[model samples]
Target: MLGHEERYDVLKRSLAREARGFTLIELAITLTVMTVLILMVVPSFTGWLNNSKVRSVAEALQNGLRAAQAEAIRRSHQTAFVLTSATPAPNTVASTSGSGSNWYIQVLPVYVGETLDPNPMVQSGSFGNLAPNVKVTASPATASLVCFNSMGRLVANSDATTSTNFGTTCTAPTGNITYDVTLTGATHPLRVLVGLGGQVRMCDTTRVLSTSAPDGCP
Candidate 1:
């Protein structure tokens, strides 16, 4: 029962009320929602980022190794792939053993009637240095050097006893030199597996890449 002028005044008041900014309670509720959304999204994003970085590193390593192998075969020359770590605190083989930290592989051209060096000193141009933050601690293997002949065939690694304890170094098959990777803070840590055929494969602990049963690495 309002006149046109009275209706106009009422509508003006409603417009002013509607134009008011959010209240503290509304702001608090909105902030809570936004925080919840962020909390839910951040972990997934972080995991994805970490996983991508790990995969990239693994691929880079695998490609470098495979290329080195291929280059050796194509040119029929001695080629070596050196792995180094950023910080080496002298991982000891045993308390009494001396200088058990650095390790590497040397590709020696085998000649008839010539003796290949059985134990080449790591520092005697046997293995090269590793990349930044990349460390070759150890694995399940009998030797440190896995060599490939000029035909890209894995040289049958020497017969020796290797340590299987955690952080113990192991050599890849003589045919193809491969290495695995472990990322620091990834949600689903990725493992890189290299084949004697110089093919790089990847899988998580939860899944299998190869059709064959579980093994340390192919």
Candidate 2:
């Protein structure tokens, strides 16, 4: 029903409304809300990222150890899981007890003279350097070499033929015994337990250590 002049006025008002943008105060409020939301989320995200990195390293080591055990059983040969050190001491046995970023599960042939084969099988292989901020810590009494016998039994430095360079820290306990390898992050630590029965288990250190928590370390 509008005439030409009236239609022109209505179009101008519509365009003017369409051209309007958020005011300075509205933009400031929106920015403030977004900043607060980001601040609240960033810390939790950082913590989750750090925990994930540590867990990844722990799980990798666990899988490597299990694979080594399986290989020893299948091939009926000895396989060793050795911790790689950055600065290995001369004429001293390798000790997994110290902190390091890398480790290996090496499959070697049977012992001949005074030592097992120096070369490891290519199939078993070595596994990596942990996350930048993560670290590995083994039990104070941990042996550098964890080996499996022909029957897939866990043995640590039991053979006299092994090179003295492999540190002699652990003596097989009379009963069921376990050694711990821990992966530590900024907030939590995870433990990989290797038992004399050739069992490897991953445990969460952050979980409550009670019967109520089924996942608590044994």
Candidate 3:
């Protein structure tokens, strides 16, 4: 019953409604809200990422230390856990460094004339390439090598061989040898503790070690 003009007008209006979209103001407001949300989340995400790196490095170091201790007990020989920047090899001398990013464990020559084991290298690991931003600091600052006796307890050693040599004298830890792993943007730094009794553990640096706070470091 409608005329041609009315039909045309109705069809155009329907098309206009179908083609409607957000205006410039609405689009800009939506983008601004998204930007603010991203800004708010970025710092928290960065902190979490850095903390995860710290934890990974700490756990790796702890596992390495434990492996060294277990090897010493298994072989009934003195084993040296040395932190060095040197690439670990079967019979290469590893130059020790307190904050070394790599760790090497080897059975030490006990006696002056003792024949070095054919394969002295027990285990090796690298955290440098994995988490370069994570910094490791030993408690004594100069203690880079920890030796374990046949009993799997911390011991003093001045062992040296063409294959492996602990650059510094391995001194028994008075209490616990702590390796603190930290990252620049991390809110929670972690510590790897090696006790005199050969106990290795990782703990949070911000808390006190107790029954309720087992994750805390002393």
Candidate 4:
């Protein structure tokens, strides 16, 4: 019911209100809140990312050890699980690195001159390519090489020729052989435990192994 001039004035006021979205103080407060929230989330996100990398590396190593054990049982012969920094190949004689990121499995000859398959490599896997920053360390340090007998149980191998250039020898573990996988920013480092019976499992290193805490490790 207003006149043209009054209608135009009302329209102008409405437009002005619409255009005045956020004040400078409001914008500054909003930006400060958002920055605080982001700061709170970044550390948690980074920790989660690092922990995921540790777990991924641990699981890969656990699966490789299990595959080696299964191969030994299936072939009804001795097999070697060697952790090395070198590239793995059927014809390659790789050495062991205690903190290696790659793993190689092969059927081992019973004796020095025994003739078996020319290419004894069963499987090869890598954790380095997946999580380069993650560190893998064996507990005994000398347990970079593990051997499994026909019965899928840990065994000792005195043969220096099993793995070349590293003087790696497979010795039966007195107890569980553990490989700790960790990252610098990770909150939950993981451990891949290889039992003397060739059982392989992954668990959190931050907790104790218990009925209530299945993800824990000793």
lDDT of the candidates, in the order given: 0.46, 0.61, 0.84, 0.85
- Model 3 spans with C-alpha error above 4 angstroms: 1-15, 130-132, 161-164
Candidate 3 minimal-lDDT segment of 10 residues: 158-167
1 or 3, greater by TM-score: 3
After TM-score superposition, the amount by which residue 61's alpha carbon in candidate 1 deviates from its true location, in angstroms, is 1.1
Regions of candidate 1 where Cα sits further than 4 Å from its true position: 1-15, 86-138, 141-145, 156-178, 197-199, 210-218
lDDT of 4 at 66: 90
Ranking by TM-score: 4, 3, 2, 1
TM-score computed on alpha carbons, candidate 3: 0.89
The superposed Cα distance between candidate 4 and the true structure at residue 213, in angstroms, equals: 0.7
Candidate 2 lDDT over 1-218, as tens digits, reads 99999999999999999999999999999999999999999988877877777778777777877877887888777776666654343333444534555555555535435344444532332335443356666554444456776677776444434454343423553443333333333466677777668777887766765789766676
Prediction 1 TM-score vs. true:
0.57
TM-score for candidate 2, residues paired by index: 0.77
Top candidate on lDDT is: 4
Question: Which segments of candidate 2 are over 4 A away from where they belong?
Answer: 86-97, 108-118, 123-132, 160-170, 173-186, 208-212
* Cα lDDT tens digits for candidate 3, 53-116: 8988988898888888899999999998888877888767778887888998888878766886
Angstrom error of the Cα, residue 163, model 2: value is: 4.9
Best by TM-score: 4
The lDDT, on a scale of 0 to 1, for candidate 4 is 0.85
RMSD of each candidate? 8.9, 4.2, 2.5, 2.1
